[model samples]
Target chain A: MAQVTLRKLVKMYDEVQAVRGIDLDIADKEFIVLVGPSGCGKSTTLRMIAGLEEINSGDIAIGGHIVNDVPPKDRDIAMVFQNYALYPHMNVYENMSFGLKLKRTPKDVIDGRVKQAAQILDITELLDRKPKQLSGGQRQRVAMGRAIVRDPKVFLFDEPLSNLDAKLRVQMRTEIKKVHQKVRTTTVYVTHDQVEAMTLADRVVVMNAGLIEQVGTPNELYHTPATKFVAGFIGSPAMNFLKCSLEQAAGALRVRVSDTLSFPVPADRTQRYTPHVGKANLLLGLRPEHITETRRHTEPNQHDFDMKIDVVEPMGMETLVYFSVGGVELCGRVNPNAGAAEATSMKLLADLNNMHLIDDATGKVL
Target chain B: MTDTAIRAGAAGPKYGSMSRDRRWALRWSYFFLVLFAIFFLTPPIYMFITSLKTSAEISAEINPWWVFNPTLGNYIELLTQDTFLRFFRNSAIVSILVVTITMAISVVAAFALARMKFWGSATLATGVFLTYLIPETLLFIPLFKMFAWVNETLGIQLMNNWWTMIILYPTLTVPFCTWIMIGYFASIPKELDEAALIDGATWTQTLTKIFIPVALPGIIAATIFAFTVSWAQFLYPLAFTTSTSELVLPVGIVTTLIKGDVFNWGQIMAGALLGAAPPLIIYAFLMDYYIAGLTAGATKG
Candidate 1:
């Protein structure tokens, strides 16, 4: 395992810059994930690190050597593509052993590696089968087997779980995690799925519009997103963004979440953001699960808002109640037994104490 | 097949006359097959029949559609003639040489254009494919003049010989073969090359080991096209080579088999039939591969 450092790595296709400039330092044996939407340049960054694409301006140093001119083979990195990229012409054993054969390793070594990988993946029976003959999950394992047989310095995965069905995706996700844990190889994986990012990454690099918005542990990003985009993207059902203004009320400050609802700002955050109160147009961010029935809330975590419930989605353990605050639809998770009767108005408790404030114009965290 | 059968079963009860409709469909299919067979087979059949008839019988005009007094004399005469044999040999040599040369250049050029992404690669690829559309008829005149100039300046006569076709047929074959190969190569997934690249295979190794084996059908079709074009090239051979010894099959057949007012109609048909055999045989056996190569783009990206 080796550390990978990308210094101002930029990828430009003529005038359209896919990745403007990204800087990252991945520690040895770290399972770093680059997570973003389509066109966010996460895959491009990963490809550049893998030597699959040329960097426009910058340097990538893997294990303390600047490998700007290295080809993929010379870079000693193995990549697993989104499509699995298993050679359709070869059987599983040949596919897994391809790299070692190309490297001119001894026949016995190649055979041993292939056999070991096949046994580890529980795919020994599939050794003679072609990629087309295998199921999607089996193909994914073969792709991994191909990577591992090389014993490369780094492993690169570009949406490797995307092509499989839902159940297979989860199964492969865990398999990949276990593989990384067992091998402890420095790896860089790219995926657009936030749930996958959250569960699979040691540290997630959240990208937006070809720029790195935030990079932290999954829990850090989910519990305290650094920007409006990160907050919205890192959560399922997304964080609700409501336009609000700060106003002085009772000698302190209040966040006016809507025309009819306003909550007094918590004592701790007022000093940090309300210096220009009553004038600043702020964005109030609340994740879906943060808002719930008052009965489920304890003292310091509760703030009530009278709202007109729009939709109630009864997800087995909890009900997702969608309502409007300041003309924007907001979702709040509640216990299923809350009996959040359909289409009626109700008082909802938002953990306003933990709410995030972002600059309305810039989407910057306040 | 299964999809059609299942759909037909689903529609059977509603239609009420499924078996009757199928029988009529089969009858119509047979009727069209007969019509098409007559349309396609009549010319070759007539040529074969006429080839077996003697010159005297052809001249008598007993029945235009019927052959009488059939004999193999025309075939015997043509085979015995030294000039006809020379023409046959020259055509065979020229076509085989051209096919070999064309396939070599076209295959490498196609591999470069399809897989390699060097500087100016995309523009060069477009330009290469576009060159195929420049007609051979337009190119031949300048080429003829250039050959004459070469003979005048360099003291070497490249024209009035069958070997000149070895040089010219590549112009016709390379671009088209290369274009077809590019389409065929592009139809293969890019991921295959990536897999090969990571597998530590160089571009050449990957091409020979992985792509060439996979794209054999395309190579076969291109080879057949190249060979057929070289063998059947009448305009270039006729325009350049005029002497009896230098003449190829097509021109030799017309010149020697027809003398001023009289035509050796039987031998002419026999020579035409013989000349058409090789390509017909190649296509008959590998028709699926030829169609597969042509329809690669339609079936794949």
Candidate 2:
């Protein structure tokens, strides 16, 4: 059991800093995913923790002891590389047993550990075949098997599923979760794909540029995002942003978009956000599902837009209607039976109760 | 009417001459390949023909290409001669010793240079490869004088013997062998080493268990190159060893096969043919390794 911690971790490659002062505490048996776009320093952070990379300037503690000077071997960490760095010359049984052999583990014990790891990965039948003889998925399983047999304190995966095809990636994604269930090793998994992060991580660390933008449970990142980048990055198809201003009318705060749409702020947030009224240009953030289609004209139209529908995408179960507001195109999911058509004028009901108000200057939830 | 229809169909000028150009391209490839084969094979084929001739027929006014009176008398004479066999034995010993020494030094040096990433590593590696480009002829005079100084000052004579080559051939073989091995070791993905490290392997364990096995092809290529280079070496052996027994294959044949000022052409060619056999046989069997070792770094660059 290992709880890994990084305090003020920093990595600078020449002048470009890849990881800038990342501090995190990964608890025992927790599957944490460091997710971001390419070059977001997620993988660099993982490598630093694995001791594969020299910690440029930081303290790394594993299981309550400072392990900054420990080499990867002494750290008791097993890393699965993106390319599945399985020794191509060795068969699966030998591959799984290689680390134990290096440690001079007894022959019978080595055999037993390898057999157990192979069984866990469902690769027992492929124990005698070289990596080249195995398919891509099988090679991946052997790579994981190599790590599993070691029974390492921590498992470091640097995008292990990135090399597999789409169907295999999804299948292996679940298989990885199952492996974690069996072993319960504190795994530091890295990937740029957010879906993998969402589906697999106990806690997702969203990184941008070189800093941790936010860290929380997957549900927290989806429901409530701390920054504009996180808000836009976490969800599928992304949240749409419209430029608007906050104004007061008859002592009630309302967000006005051009002169077309006006959304009233609830009483609880009025005092907190009323100081910079009119001058405070706030971004109106709304997820696609919250934007709905209204029938004809409705009474008490507090949230409404006369959006011209440009493309209608009907996904049998639901229709995704695309329309433009002040030259910014936005997508909304509607019931397929609602008869959402393309190239027609449509009235959209902005679901104000479910709507999120984001400060335009700083992308924070209002 | 036919001319008008043809003109209408032939709207573009490029299509008409394209097929003609392709035919010439094909013809040129065949022409050069055959030319290359002849240019390369002529010397060895001529040597074989001369080796088969009797002494009288070799000196007679006969076509250079033909063995007029076919005989293996030259081969039998060289094989039976004690001094001639000594020359072959010396050549074989020097080359084998040098191959073993070069590979031992090169594999270690290559591993360190390629993977260790110490100070001035890149510059030192480039220097090693560059040392190979400096011809042995250029270093021969310096090396000869150095040996003479060692004999005078340190009281150990290294010149004029087969052992001299044991020291010098490694100088020739190690740098080139190391450079090729470096290329081979570098082609092994860094991930393999990383995995090995996490598997509780010290750097040495990783080098032996993983890197060596993965880089075996490169090792074989380097060994073949070292062997071929050491076996065929002429300049060092010729300059250093003059005694009949100490003379290696190349100089041995030239010195002994001449009587006074008269050249024994048939016996000389026979000795030459025999001397070339080991390397030729090795190359024929392991040509794939030889060629791959030479070109493995091209993919790297």
Candidate 3:
């Protein structure tokens, strides 16, 4: 296993820049995930690191060796593509052994490696079956087997689970995590699924529009997103943003949303937003889980407010309640037994400890 | 009771007319198909019938369709003749050699044009297809003049040799085969080649180990086309090679079977039938692959 470092990586396709000046240091034996929406340059970054794409201007060093001029075969990296990319003409054993044979490994070693990989992927019975005969999940296992048998220094996955059905994607997601744990190879997995990134990566690199937005541990990203974009992109159901302005009211910093609904900023975070006082377009970011119906866990910074519920969806474990706050739609998580009903008034608590105050103009967490 | 009556009345004509329309459509399709089959099968049937008849029976002023003396005489005679065997041998050699040359050149050219992006490769690919569009009738004259110039300057007589067909046939086959192969090669997913490259295979190794095996159906289709063209080519072989020994099957059968004013119909029919057998056998065996290769690019793109 080796650390892959990318310094000032830039990729330009004619006039369009696909990857722009990305610098990341992926440590040895660390599972790093690059997650973003489509066309965010995450896959392009992975491909550049794999040497499958030419770098316009960058330095990519794998195991402390610069591979800028190296061909893909000499990159000492293996990739699992989204489509599984198995040779349709070859059986499972042949497909797995192809790379080793190209390396001119001994027959016994090739057989042992292929069989071990197949055993790891649970595809031992499919050794003699061609790709066309296998189901999609089986083919995926075979593709992984092909990559594992190479035992490359780095493993690159470009949306490898996107083609599977939902349940199988989840199953294979855990399988990949298990495989990485066992193999402990330096891996960079690219996917648009934030949940996959959170579950799999030792570090999650959130990218947007050809630039890295944020890089941190999953817990750091979840609890303290560095930007408005990262906060919105990382969570499922997404964090809600309410456009409000900060003003000094009676010697305490209070955000004025409307005539009646305004809450004081937390005492510790008040200093961060003090410079932006009288700013009319500050955004208040809140996750769904942070807005609760119960008041027993409230701190000194927490505040309670009343709002009319527009719709309520029971999710078995918890309930999701949607309501309007100062003409902006916001979702709050509540207890299923809280008796939420449409168009009815309900009391909700906002935990200010986890709230994010963002600058509207810059979209940055203040 | 009134509602039930209304529902039945609303549905009655629609269901009946739908069945009637489908039946008529099926009948028309089969009728046209049989008509087309008869039109296509008549010439081969006639050739087989004529091949089974003696010269006496052919010119006996009898019923033209029926053979009074059904004979294997023509078949036995053609099979025994040294000249006929020589023509068959020459044609076989030319067709096989042409196939090998065409496949080799086309596979590499197609891979380079389709997968390997260089300067002006798109234009070059279009130029190749455009070359295929240029008729052999138009190309043969200039090719003949060039051969003559080479002979005058380089002291090489390429005009009357059987192996010259091996050299010249690719001019006809390569452009077309290359175009077909370009389509086939382009139809394969780009990821497969990337996977092969990452698997430690070089470009040549990828072509041989991954591409050639994956695109085997296309290669077989191209080989069949090349063989058929070389075997059945008439104008070039006739213009270039005058000797009976050097002539390929198509020209040999036509020239040797007919003397100045006499057409040897029985032997000519027998030779033509025999000349067609190789391609026929190949198509019979590989028809599915041929169709797949032909249509792979259109459907994929």
Tell me, by TM-score, which candidate is best: 3
Q: Which lDDT tens digits does candidate 1 get at residues A87-202?
A: 66678898898788878999998989888888778899999987777777888898899998898899999999887889989988999999988888999999999999999999
> Per-residue CA lDDT of candidate 1, range B1-301, in tens?
9999989987878576877889899999999999999999999999999999987888884886887677888888888989888989998898888889988888888899888988997898788778888887888899988998999999889888778878888888898999888988888778778878877889888888777866888999899999899889888888888888898888889988899988889999999988888889888988886565322211112
Off by over 4 Å in 1: A247-253, A267-276, B1-34, B63-70, B76-82, B118-123, B288-301
Ranking of all predicted structures according to DockQ, beginning with the best and ending with the worst? 3, 2, 1
Give the interface RMSD of each candidate.
5.6, 6.2, 5.2
**Estimated TM-score per prediction?**
0.91, 0.92, 0.95
DockQ for each numbered candidate: 0.30, 0.37, 0.42
Q: Report how closely model 1 matches the true complex, as a DockQ value.
A: 0.30
In candidate 3, list every pair of residues with a backbone clash.
none
After TM-score superposition, the amount by which residue B186's alpha carbon in candidate 3 deviates from its true location, in angstroms, is 0.8
Candidate 3 residue lDDT tens string, A175-259: 9999998888999999999999999999999999999999999999999999999999999789999888898766678876668
Question: Model 3 TM-score?
Answer: 0.95
1 or 2: which has the higher TM-score?
2
**What does DockQ come to for candidate 2?**
0.37
Q: In model 2, what are the clashing residue pairs, if there are any? A: none
**What local lDDT does model 1 show for residue B26?**
100
